[model samples]
Target: MAKLTDMEELASKIIDKNVQSYMREALTCYMTGAYRATIVLSYIALFDDILAKLDVLAKVNKKAKKIYDEVSKKRGNQEVFESDLINQLSSNNLLTSLDSTFLDILRQLRNKAAHPSGHKPSAEEARFIYFESINRFLSKEILSTTQLADEILASTVNKNLFPSTDITTIAKVVRKELENIHPDTYPYLISKLIEKVPSSDGIVSKNTSFFITGLTFDNNDERIVSVVRRMLIEKKSQDEDYFTMIIRSITSNPIVLETVDDVTFKRLKVIIQERISEVDSTLEHSRFSHPVSMFSSMCGVLNDEVISNNFETEFSSAIEKFLYSSYLLNNLSKSEYAKEKYIEILMSKAGSSDFEVANKFARTCYTIIDELDVILTDQNAFKLIVNLLRAASWNAFGAKDLRNAKFQSMPAIRDKARALDLNDKSEAKKIYKEVFGTDTDYENLMGKYVR
Candidate 1:
């Protein structure tokens, strides 16, 4: 039932160009009513492709290497070489029993077509051979082994091969190598990469994270989600450290949270909650700062439902407490970055459809602005105040009234607003008018408040 055009299109998917050339010739023969030549040429292409895959497998697998070596010695004898290759592949578990049987049938058809037999093949028989050969052998990559997976993972560490800081570029490099790997190898490859997450520190850590994130988010592979869920479940009880590290990494790529099942998501929520609870603002240097910042970053991306149910109170309180404490504010660069993340989290939360959620965030921002005003002696704190105000004013959620009230009540904030350059003041007035539907006369309110 297969048409010559369909057969040629399938042949084009063959990764091996040499095999493609042979299949092209076979299709040409099939079109010309040369049925015997079509069968012989298609079989030759399939066999050659299998041999090419064997060579690649041999480089990474010892069993494949042994089989390849034996096949190489018998290459002078065509019949013996073909028979030995199939037997060795079957014996080594490289080819399934069904696959071996299929190859054997194709080989027999090739034999019949090559010899001067009284029997002549029909068009259907030749088309069947062409389609079977291309689909079963020529189009698929070799079965991927653990060693091959490791080889691919190892190659990712080479800077020359993966030299991009951009995650999209790095993911492309990873995908190019992984696309050739058989699908059966994905679970093992994923497990190995997960194991690497806790220990890998530099570029290796980044590549591993981006690759896993790409699989889950970019490719939308359900198998990846299932594997990660199963692995996390196993690691949760068996290896807490491994489980925690993976959770931390997943928080960095929070879109992954959207893919997990509810139970797994709830577990992740509890773990993140436990981690955030350990943050001690009193300490001169809390080791938990990183996790807190990560959680804040995650909150900035998650939807209102997840934020309200899992993180609303805890995250808001944590950011407020951290901002109020001197520990973060004392470190200029770190404090600026943390403030930026905190403001982003608040901005996202302030957009919530739930009035209580959005209103609560406005109150948090109001209090944070008060704290920033107390610390306004620090030039960095002053800049953060302006940034937070500018960011908050842009969100048209239920918080606008609360923000306007706070702005009117705070004299120091009024003085700071009065000191703003023309562009920033104009930008602020524009956004405020856009958000609150009113233009505030900053010049009129200047003398009424004491700095």
Candidate 2:
């Protein structure tokens, strides 16, 4: 329990605190790089339902879906790609309140990513993917539709883009085209564009004030409830007019300091580190009209502040201050369940094909084991087993089954994986039988293991 003095901070911290485990996993996976695609793909396919519920925004909306169908039909046609897609949306009855002009812009990027040799999204794109996917697919109605709109629009403003010298630049071109949607979101879109762009002109000023204003706010509304969406599967480019509008809009409604509850405060702390200079400190901790259960998160992902000044220079001190705050994180880590859960998430991600992120996580876990007690406890030992199993065959199973899978016997699972080194199915099986009862195995591992 939190003491009275720290109640406010604790309240805000709750929101940010819940996901450190997942974030830890993501970070480790990021370092390995081998399991990134698998992790991302599996996450989407597996947790499709959870994501759908939580998602405050849908990816295709009605407009994008219309275009999607048309594009699918004209497999080889390039001349009228946009028209084909638009027609398909009109025909499919997927059309809704969202704008088609924006869908036109989105389709191009989606097509590029889906194309055989087209570019994959960069880290920024990936982050945005996580954000929008969560909003469209998994997020609950934390705010009303009106408030939801406001949060998204307001957040987008902070994610502004600066002027580019090159008018013909692909990213800039993309932005100009997307203005039909919110027009204000262009700056953050530009931020995402730069994140996806390969060594192109950088987006300066991060999630600062340069923003597009006047977009309506979305309070949690029931209109889009229980709807599954895949909002952003690709990243768009930047444009001059869109960029200017975003910058102008945000400057007009500069991000003010937010008076956050504990739940939101931790989130602010985590996000603020990206690029401190651009952070509207006053704005980050402010209170909003949304409910805790259904509020939209990941709004800060595209904040121009992150893309502006170096986060190292901008947010390091603030992060440090938060970490040292009277045994806050220390207490959390000391809890065996929490520590083990964190490790399980991290290690699971580490046991992937992406060697860089995987290895990075493994090393981090090693350090934790050597350094932290809770992470290495008897309870955690079993927890590690469950995590290992989850990691060893993440892509092989349905994500929906994860929640139901028994984990009480993780200790045995861990020992089995290690005894066979996750390489010899026979040895692992033999060990499994010994520990789990039944099953005699010396050969034909998969066949026996399946039994």
Scored by lDDT, the top model is: 1
- How well does candidate 2 match the true structure in TM-score terms? 0.20
Q: What are the per-residue Cα lDDT tens digits for candidate 2 across 68-92? A: 4444445445344544534443344
* Cα error, candidate 1, residue 282 (Å): 12
Error of 1 at 128 (Å): 3.7
TM-score to true structure, per model: 0.58, 0.20
lDDT of 1 by residue, 410-448 (tens): 556555655552336665455445433565643442233
- Provide the global lDDT of candidate 1 against the true structure: 0.61
